[model samples]
Target: MAIFLTGVTGYIGSYLAAELLEQHGESLNLLVRAEDSQEAQRRLWRSLQLHFGFPVFHEHLSARIRIFCGDLTSPRFGLNDEKYDLLVSSTDSVLHCAASLNRKSEKSCLNVNLRGTLEVIQLARRAHDAHGLRRFSEVSTVAVAGQRRNEQVTEDSAIDWDRSDYDPYARTKKFGEHLVRELLPDVPRTIFRPSIVLGDSRRPETTQFDMVRAFVFLGGLPVLPFRPDDCVDIVPVDYVADAIVTLHQSPRPKYEIYHLSSGVNSESFRELTAALAEARGKMKPLFWPELEAPFRAIVERLSRRRDNLGYTASRLEVFLPYLVWNTVFDNTRVVAELRRAPAPFSSYCFSLFRYAKENRFRYPYREWPEIATLPSTARDSEYSESARHVSAGEPAK
Candidate 1:
């Protein structure tokens, strides 16, 4: 009875597989997309190194694994009918994690997020009819909560607005969830909705993006644009992984949509900026209160119309909506379930920023369009120059 998994190569999927290997132990047929056999092994090995490190996969578990290559967008997962039929007759669980993360368009989102998910369900229904598989699980997002503006957004709360049916990404996740709900009524199912997935809390190995970038962007600037009231939710990747394991391992209730989130740890935009400044920039907490009234006056004047602001001004204009407003989400249901389970650990903006700054770790989250343009301060020039000459600087033999 193996778990048939998809998205084994993605950030969340990679970590999830590691956890599953530890708890569920190897009985997995991972779905991946690779050009050829060699490349597939290379990709799997590389991903294993990131999670379990060097010696490839963690011991005792490597031999129990298997791989299946296919595109989620294709029917029967792009596998030939013979193979598909065999898969249909074998696996016990389908953990559908593959989805197009592209935020660029609604149609692309629908194709991968919605239709691709339906394809997995179609297969699951066939597999259940054929082999009597046990459960189908999906990795959805807290964003499916969609633009709600309040605290304590509980699991029982009705989706006030069908935000998913509108926003490209949200719609895809929502629609995908819909497919699973609609077609697989008899099969056991679990839907997990995680909030902004952060990097590893302990190892710091990461690729999930959002908060880190925002903090990095602020740290690179000379001035901190202070807005003390706006907030963003942060949740660690480990927590999401842990929650899934908990839900799966437990006698999960039927048709449960669990919001696996931080539940607390709300960071106001100003506090977040201050943390990054303190962590990486080693800058002081000098809020420009004197500039506030004037800044507001300027912003108010510019907001007379959508196109009132010029190119530079409009860029700021476009980004301003995020700065001034955002609500919070709640996760009591999952938290209550995971009362004793290891809680998710998000970065202490200050601590993470400080470590990254002191260690001179690349501010990877920050867009570097003007990195080359910024004149090298006393901080970088000589270090940059000397670093280029390996011949002059002999190895520490």
Candidate 2:
């Protein structure tokens, strides 16, 4: 058996590829885009091998792994004709994890998110189902639920278009979902919708766009308007990888989509700031209008010198969005699935934060513990009750 994985060079793909090498008796044909196929393939091998910190990374098993240099937008992954056919036939599953995650570029997002997904689905249908091509697992986003203000956006929800249809990226993801649902009605499809993926789980080593890290970083300084209840759905990268792998191990549902979020533990803006602050030993609890007065003055004074001030001001880039915004991911489906097969919640839960602080991969603070012991203040906080009471689906009191 072979697993054809796209975006093998990416964060999630790297972890997934390593797991595949460890768990299944299958080779991985990773779709890579590079200037030269031969050199590119070798580079990817070295990367995946070095990243496998465990002694388990089988160095001699290089024969089982192969790499194909190709662009997702190109015909059959832009491979030469023979390689294309070989790829189409040799794999038992295609994990379509490649995509343009640029939040700013709508057109690019649509091209990769919508059209790219359609292409993956089409190619999979061409494979010999009799030969055991079991599935096409798509990496979607919880954003597809869009602006369903307070609607319990379940896997069964009809993918509310009005909310999803706005952002080009969301529109494309929703479109991708539509395409998969329209497939042969026989082809097994699994959609995993993960919200904001955060730091690496086992260690703080991270390559994720963790806005939470930014907010946490900002927390130490005098920023104002920081509330305790604002929150967002931040799941550790390992949990995201594990959930995707978990969804695969379970019996394929007739049709299924799992929301790969931190589930109900979704942090509010304040709670998030508090967590990072608590991790750093400087969690703020009340309004500080006076603090902002001097802070803005310092910034305004600094803004004058383009070279010096601009350089210093960029320091605030990580914390710019700390004041507001919360994206609560309803993971009812994902939670039930997790409970059925519990892996230590500690692996991805608050322990990950401890790993970050200890290694200095994130917040430059004292280690809460060798394994993070969520501080009593943080542990006792009523943020969870507040996060749930204000759950996105329920009516406000």
Best by TM-score: 1
lDDT for each residue of candidate 1 in 1-397, tens digit (9 for 90 to 100): 5778788788788777888887775377777786543345446655555566423352322345555667778888788777677667767888887787655467788788987888889889988988786778899876666555445566556354534332577767876787888899998889988766656666554554334444444456565456455566667777788887767666655438887765555676566666555555466454554564576566556645555233224334333333343545567677777774323332444555555445444323322122122222211101122112222332211
Candidate 2 ranges with C-alpha deviation above 4 Å: 45-50, 53-61, 128-132, 148-152, 164-166, 209-213, 224-227, 253-255, 283-327, 340-397
Looking at model 2, residue 123 earns an lDDT score of 70
The TM-scores, one per candidate, come to 0.74, 0.73
Once all C-alphas are superposed, what RMSD does model 2 give against the true structure? 14.8
Per lDDT, the best of the predicted structures is 1
> Candidate 2, which ten residues in sequence have the lowest lDDT sum?
378-387
Give stretches of model 1 more than 4 Å off. Answer: 54-62, 161-166, 209-211, 222-226, 253-255, 284-325, 340-397
lDDT of each: 0.61, 0.59
